[model samples]
Every structure is written in structure tokens, then in C-alpha cells.
Target: MENSTQITIENIQYSLSDIEKDCWSRLVNGAVKSRSPFHTPAVATFGQKEISLRTVVLRKTIPETREIRFHTDVRSRKWAELLSNPAISALFYDASTRIQLRLNGLASLHQHNDITNDAWQKTTLSSRRCYLTLHSPSSFSDIPTSGLTEDIEQENLSFEESEIGLKNFGIVSIHVQSIDWLWLHHAGHRRAFFDYTDGKYQWMIP
Candidate 1:
């Protein structure tokens, strides 16, 4: 049988503004800490035939501008999708907290720009190896492959060789337009919605 016990959290009443503040705080932590539940979020973008969704590593969050950053390969379908239609959605959930944050935003790609340069500089050669793939993401092949040359995939490349991957690297920055926050509890579930573009917020049925 499943455990019937509800998780009890510490006491503290939160106002709407407090909840918003906490959301951004958690986002910032997620970008820097790999252990954070928010460290990886699912980002969705409009694709050619259907809505595309994929898991992305949380790179950075700018509360001042309500923007979130993620890195990707410029040759990937997602990068192309964002170029055609910037509309994007990001989702973050913390099982322990029973909290879910659903965000709608417009995403812009950055490449051969300062943003990409800064992000690229922060990454190690191992992480950059993905960019060294011989073909764009989702390219059909006779045999399955990671898309990287043997040396690159095997971590046999030096920093000089790894630099080649920078040409395929880029960053996606999302300008948050709205947020739907949901909380689950045994007593009752709570939900709130914040629309930045509309400059309004409200409680909603969970």
C-alpha cells in the first residue's frame, strides 16, 4: 500500500509577493547548484509539425529582467524552432515541496555574441563536446551515433580542439511573460497565476 502520510513542512504564511520572490530565489539556486531540483527544467518550443519538448539545464536567471537562460546547439531543431517562433514554455517542479512552476515566455537565441561567449567560457571541454557533433540534432543515419567524432566523444580532444565546438554553441534567453504556480497539500491544493505582460495576478482554482 502507498504511504497515506502527508509531508509536514515548517510553519510560515506566505503572501503572493513572498511566493513570487521565493520562486525567483529558487530559480537562481537552480542555475548554480547541480543538486537543486530546479537545476534541470523542461523547455517547450513550437516545432515544424508539433510542439517540441526537451529537458534543458538551467543556466542562469535574471530576476530584474524576468529572464532565464539555457544553452544549446545552434544546429539543433530547437534552435531553428525558436528562430521561427520564439514562443516557449518552461516547467519546474520540486517533488519534496510539492510545488510546480509553469512559465510562458518568449525565447531569443544568442550566438557569436557576448552572451554566448560568456556562457561558452564557463563550460568545460567535456560539456562542449556535444557541440562537436558532425551533424545537427535528429539527423537520420544508417547507424546510431552520438554525432561526435570518436576522439571528441571519448574526451581525447584538447582545449584547442574543443574550441571548434564553440561555432555550434549558443544560448537561449527567455523573457518570462507569465507564471502559473501550483502547490499540493493533503488539506487542500492552492494555485496562483501571475501575468507580467498584463501586469496582474490572481488566485486560481487548483
Candidate 2:
């Protein structure tokens, strides 16, 4: 029999194990259903000589494939950083469950391709406005603005108007290689580490 434990978070019960499968299942559930911003993970990428971290929304999760996706502007600094180095780390914490997940993975960027086109097609016009900016993300400006052009009315933009933003849209797919799961409790803490590349799963002292 597989060793398991029952835990409750936000009135939902989960039968978890000291393995990658259960942990990944819970993570997918959190990303898809959790209303908290904790679902937005902090992704760290290799910078010039150091590591840069930024919070990004979790757009999709594929447990079977061990992949997660997030959208971004192709002109963003992080996009450039990922292009230089695909290796990255993502951190997620759920306050309600007191669970922390650290994931290490390789990211693939999709731009001006079928992947980007599919993602853009599913995005709403309002959300697409961010990619229609007159300048690339993080550009220096004398004045602060919403990033969109002064003449472009936010709510009035038509589908064709939003289509122009497709050129700036990009999708990032992270293929997870390892995951570290930690749970905090007053009585005792539990932790587990999983390495998919080596097919190893073990409990760690917490």
C-alpha cells in the first residue's frame, strides 16, 4: 500500500503522498481554482551575472506533461533573459494551505507561431490591449502612461484593433524537471523532493 496522509485546505480534503504525482495534482488544482494571487508564481531567470525574479500569472498547467504556461510580451526583459538561458525556477506559496512549491524547469518561448496564435485567440480584447503598447515593456519615458497609445481608447478597441497586438504576444512553456514541496504546521512540518529527470522522490527532514 502507498503511504498517504489526509489534509484539509479551505474545507477541501486531499489524499497526498510523498511522491510527485500527488503533489503535482494538488498544484494543478490550486492554479486552476485558487482565487488567491498565490497562484501567481515568482519565476526566476538567469541575469547577466545574477538571478532575476518576477511574479507572473499561471496561465495553464499540464500535470501529465509536467509543463506550465504563462503569457508575456515578447519585448519584455524577462523574455530576453529566457532567450539567453532557458533554465529557470518558479516559486509558489498558498497561505491558506501553508504549502510552498519550488519548481525547476526549462522554458521554451513561442512567438509568431501556432502556439502563440492559439493563446492569442483565446485572450480577450481587453487583456490584449497590454500588448498593443506604443513602446516595448520597461521602456524609459518622461511621463507615466498606461502603456497604450494616447489615441487608442481602451474599451472601444475592436477585434481588428486588438489583432495588431499579436505581434508582441508570446507564450512561455516550462517543462518541469524537479519540484520541492513543503507544508507548514504548528505540530510538525512535512517536506518532499521530486526529481523527474532521475525518477526520484524522497522525503526531506523539515
Candidate 3:
């Protein structure tokens, strides 16, 4: 019989296969559109042993170039760790379809670039306000203060006063090297791995 042509939750069964190299190519190239409500990238950072997970907005993806981008605060612990060890992993889960993908890549910080600047500009005021805080990421305080302080300095303000807080904006770009996909079904489970370096995709025991 011919394979299912539709690419929805119901047709996902037919699309099951190795985490195709082309999938990685599309992800890296920002070709495959995101159907999940999470238009951003979800990343998992490894600590000494524990794991830190958070939603990271996808900044850019260049499949042919093998580059993926996300952003965060420079003062964050994740930023410090990525600097020491570029290797990182990001997980994308689509609960509606029971699909979870683990992506492995090397992450690099972009401190200066049009892309970073553009992303900073696009940031909403509520989000940009995050950069105005005096405390560093994970810093502790005796009392609770709003995430943003009202006393932003005039000299530090940007041309668009609204963007003044974005001075601390930091962008991270992850260059994917491999990907693994896991699918859970009522009858059985499927798992696959893809290696970009080798251009191969193979099924694996779940």
C-alpha cells in the first residue's frame, strides 16, 4: 500500500523512521516549520550531574550551514557553562503526537552581530525589561523585587528608550551534529538516531 500522504497527528505513524538526515538538515536549515505551540527551541543544559531545561526562542537555523540559534542572558549560568563546554543538547517534544527529539550540538555565543541586534530589537518590552535588573542570574536577595527595576539610567538608554534593557541580551547559536528521535505508541515504541557527521540514520532499541 502507498504510504500516508498527510503529515498530521494521525499520519505520524507512517512518517516513523530513523531520525532522517534530511530532518536534521531541515532543522539546522530552519526549513521544517514548527507545528508545536513552542515556536522557540527547548534546551537542556547539563550541570555536574543534574539537568536544567528551559524554553529557548529559536533565533535562526541554517541546515546547509549546520547552524541553530537561540538566545539568553549573558549573566545566566547556562551561558557560563556553554562557554567552558560548547557541547549541549536540546529536546523538542510534541505531546499531541507523542514525539520527542533530542538534538546534540556545539553551542557558541554571539555577542555582536546584526542577527543578535535584530533579535534584540524584536524583543517585547516586558521581556526586554529583564536586562535592567542589577542582579546576575541566580543571584539571591533578601526580599523580592520586581524582575525589572524602575530606575534605568538615562545614559545607558538605547535610541529606542524601550530597548534600553536589552543591553544585556545574549544570543547563542547551536550547530547541530546529531539527533535522536523517540516515538511512543500504544502497541510499541520506536527510537532512531541520526549522525550528521556520517550522514546516516538508524533505528535503535528503545
Q: What is the TM-score of each candidate against the true structure?
A: 0.94, 0.87, 0.76
lDDT ranking from best to worst? 1, 2, 3
Return whichever of 1 and 2 wins on lDDT: 1
Q: State model 1's lDDT.
A: 0.88
Give per-residue CA lDDT, model 2, range 8-58, as digits (tens): 544555443424565666667656764754468999999688888998888
Error of 1 at 8 (Å): 11
TM-score winner: 1
- Candidate 3's error at 53, in angstroms? 3.3
lDDT of 3 by residue, 6-36 (tens): 1223533334342364355435433235554
Relative to the true structure, candidate 2 reaches a TM of 0.87
Report the number of clashing residue pairs per model.
0, 0, 4
Error of 2 at 121 (Å): 0.7
Clashing pairs for predicted structure model 1, backbone only: none
The lDDT values for all models are: 0.88, 0.82, 0.68
lDDT of 1 by residue, 1-206 (tens): 11222212356666677677888999999999999999999999998789999999999999999999999999999999999999999999999999999999999889998888888888998899889888888899999789888877789988887898899999999999999989898887878888999987777889
The parts of candidate 2 lying over 4 Å away from their true place are 1-19, 34-38, 151-153
